[model samples]
Target: MSIQSGQSAIEILGPEQPESAAILSAQALQLVEELAERFNVRRDELLQLRLEKQAQIDNGKLPDFLPETASIRNSDWQILGIPADLQDRRVEITGPVERKMVINALNADVKVFMADFEDSLAPAWDKVVQGQANLRDAIRREIDFTHPTTGKSYALRPDPAVLIARVRGLHLDEVHLHWQGRPIAGALVDFGLYFFHNYQQLLDNGSGPYFYVPKLQSHLEARWWAEVFAYTEERFGLQPGTIKATCLIETLPAVFEMDEILYELRNNIVGLNCGRWDYIFSYIKTLRNHSDRVLPDRQAVTMEKPFLNAYSRLLIRTCHRRGALAMGGMAAFIPAKDPAKQEWVLNKVHADKELEAKNGHDGTWVAHPGLADTAMAVMDQYIGELPNQMAISRDSDAPISAQELLEPCQGEATEAGMRANIRIAVQYIEAWISGNGCVPIYGLMEDAATAEISRASIWQWIKHGTHLDNGQLVTVQLFEKMLLEELVTVREELGEARYENGRFGEASELFRSLTSAKELTDFLTLPGYQILTQKTVA
Candidate 1:
């Protein structure tokens, strides 16, 4: 492998000691530099294209199936055959790339552990670099964690789940890495470093450098990743198509182009995940101009809703048609300590997974290790003795339309729902800003995407002048009043002392700024990243 660019040195602007020593070796940095030199330009161009597309949406051009990609959509094509290690993903567990969580998740009874470097992770410099070190140790089964005070130790079991790393989206930039004075794309930094260090080792262990690509907006973005995989294979002297990716159909534009996306990454992508939370956020942002698109309560927008029902069926049909796995979204519920509540949540999870399995999802996502057994049980029942449900096809009598996918829920919006949204936004953001991206709140594991949709729903409600079922108008004044009231509720919930020191004020203000701005922010994390980095530098 040779560097095509006329550069010999790679500059890492971040710290160079300790944790960085393990993952950012000279060879690994070379791979990252090569990836940046080759793909970073195209990444920037694609992000700009996203901005242009959003402008068109703002100008009343609603998102729909692309006419230009009609040939790709209508054509007969399938992605490369499913890789051996990824063929039976009955239940997949996901969490941030943290050490203790890494050891526990891998040991859980699941087929795959998607070590997320994206929404589930807070991208502080120390955390980001340390996460890479953790993943490297995990892949080698050399990971162990000791409780600082309790003196308990945690380690990987004899056999662990297959690891699939999810990198940051294209829009984020890793400021600690620079190429010719420009920040390197965070996606490249995460994917390149991980693959550079582990691809060969994984192959030696009968697996490959698998990934869960997040927040992709279109087929072109999928094509970009396909090219990246091709280039990486060449750079590392590996067989073509050794890397397998699962693109998250999280964005509205992506939902319309699922078939085209799989066609673009036919050589590298093996599955498609229904990123439900981010999908809702994308729905609100995409149709923010239309008053009818204002969503009801967040809780009311479940998988059983019409839009989601169509999305699930359509996803299953699209993936099976192309010989790819249709992975389900996260069931964020965690078992509560209260016995009655625990049973209720577990039943909910079981029902959720049952629906997916019956609808022919090959696999599903569980946010906690505890839910693995329930999810696996449901999958086992529907997919008994079968590697996957890829053979299943949609019946001729049932067909989904673009309009069904676009329709909003008929559930009523309530004042309690509004308060819950604000409460979650504040609580989740507080946890996020403090460098904890995934928080278990009210028995549910809330991540950045959950918080995003919470705030986006509020914004859409206020903008559309939506009225709650109780006859109160959802005006800016009402929202502000509710915000103040919820702040008090949050303070009381967390206690006065914890509230004072917890950055609740900062979280509240940040949530307000994002949701109340005249123009919607492309991503809540973009500004939230600034706060995290600033706090770390201080």
Candidate 2:
């Protein structure tokens, strides 16, 4: 048997047995000597590994349990393989009961969809295998998602966004668990083994997984994942580069180690996502509060200007350096209601497209499928066509360098696009207050956390760039000037009038309304607004 530190051992009856046996006996002696030299210095690791090998053999499993490890290789972190452009792609998920959403999204031409087993699912532990069972039984034979016992059927069937983990060949799904949420080094090998087999099944379907690795802490974390990934070749008998991974740089630590993360997982890397809401929370909770940095209100400090600019630029550079696709984060949901709200969602999507396209991102996520058309339309609008090295053009006379066309699109988007998006964002905000969701944002979605997400959407846009509207771009300077001239007065007048009788339910309802509005205005009231005005004048 093979052993660590390059050693082996065996025994025989006599030194003068058959020729082969004697030769084997001598080789066994040589192996013992090597083992003595290598493992003699160590007591437990060598002995324990041997014992595990014995157990595997006795159970008719592994003939040899060799350690599969490797250092990082190939520095290609181009996130270009993403299914859609970062700014415009709609990535709605089907809940355990939401399969139809996937078809609906597809019918509308959304860029991507996920069958979520993480947050959207409540997979019971005892029935842990059920999740994979549901996926496999459905993937292979197309079983109904109806709970036979309950006689209740799911409206939407599961759609695999990343590969379905543990579904032979669907292992990349587990990347999110290991890389994203939290780091646990040892459990990773187990996870890798479980997913490797899934890749085989994925190949059967003529598709391979494109994973989203969540919550990566640093370049080191990405590196470790790469190491485990290398072992998959042996685990499932696949080519070296068959599997792929994309890290979600959500945590604060990950932001600092972008280059490392990109460098380490470069070969297998897809692209990085702009995880705004969670990232902001981490930015506030980990960097500011945890580190004892006194901060203003969370909502007040829009991550638009210097922060998002620097961060996004870094992401763009990192991806471009390796020719990987760099994706922008989600534009959250814009509740549609008024014409103004429609305009706001349109503005945000287009502006997001502007920022991403300008920064070199290829794709982004749209949270709500109902709003998929708006996001997809924005992407369709901005992405004139994929970059082609050979000569190609929509109009021969209007030809321009691809770089030239996308150059000015970097910072701010068109004015018309911005105005339209802003209206949609406003409409999204109005939805909770006045739209169709069961709860009003200001009315019911009053939790500080939910309210904060709503607030950040608007402030972030204004802070980053002046949004666009039907041929009019609202530059930050113009937006600021307008706030000085008109928006702030309206806000103050409304805040005072509303807060005069702002009881618990009243304030809560206001927050609920904010969610429905799909605009950040109402949430920008209360504590969040003060934080913005106090120190973020820039």
Index of the highest-lDDT prediction = 1
Task: Flag regions of model 2 displaced more than 4 Å.
Answer: 1-108, 118-130, 137-197, 289-303, 337-343, 387-538
Model 2, position 380, has a per-residue lDDT of 54
Residues 1-538 of candidate 2 have per-residue lDDT tens digits of 1112112232221122122222223433343333333332332242344345434533434221112221221233343243322222323322221334333333334544544333223222212234444444334435455565887764333443333231111111211112112211212322332243345566676655445565555454576566555554444576665566656666555665665676677666766766655555444333221212212333333335455555666665555555555666755444567788767767766676566655555566655555566655555555556531011111223322222211211232443332332322332333322211112232121222233443343344443333343434434455434323332333454476543432323333333344334233422323322321232111
Residue pairs of candidate 1 with colliding backbone atoms: none
Tens digit of per-residue lDDT, candidate 1, span 1-538:
1122223365566654378766777777788888888999999999989989988988888788899988987888888887888999999999999999999999999999999999999888888998999999988889999999999999999889999999999999987767776878999999988998888789888999999999999889999999999999887788888999999999988899999999989999898999999999999989888887788899989999889989989999999889999999899999788999989999999999998998899999999988999999999999899899988877552767778889967888899999999999999998888899999887789999999989998888888889899999888778889999999998899899999989888899998888887777878889888888773431
- Give each prediction's root-mean-square deviation over alpha carbons: 2.7, 19.0
Clashes of 1: 0
Q: After superposing candidate 1 on the true structure, give the runs of residues whose Cα lies further than 4 Å from its correct spot.
A: 1-9, 395-397, 535-538
